[model samples]
Target: MPGYHSFTANIIYNLAQLGIPIRDSEFFDIQTYLEIVEIHKNVYAGETPSRQATQADIDTFLG
Candidate 1:
């Protein structure tokens, strides 16, 4: 399968769509935010308060 393109490491692909830049640093703590979406991927199938997924995300960023 070789007909499309790819991306780099775990980095946010669609910053505009995600509306990440709009989040205030005082609220979402953007300073400590480390988006892990496989580089070109911008789809994280989960919610923020979802313990199952958010916990892992927190662990990854805080750890």
Candidate 2:
């Protein structure tokens, strides 16, 4: 986890704050759901532009 940012961790924390359920699984379904929710939250935060990263951006970084 050396290079990992806290983005996903923060999403999980926020989900907990909103009374959403979380569970650990081999497929990580809950974490995936929360990540999308977090992205939407950032996108619709009422700004002139959105800072939510695109899938291509993520793909570039992943590559």
Clashes of each: 1, 0
Model 1 scores what on Cα lDDT?
Answer: 0.43
Best by lDDT: 2
* Deviation (Å) of 34 in candidate 2: 7.2
- Compose the digit string of candidate 1's lDDT tens values, residues 1-63: 343333211123444444555434235433344442233243454434445667778899899
> Which candidate number would show the highest TM-score if scored against the true structure?
2
RMSD of each: 14.2, 14.4
Q: Which portions of model 2 show Cα errors greater than 4 Å? A: 1-3, 24-63
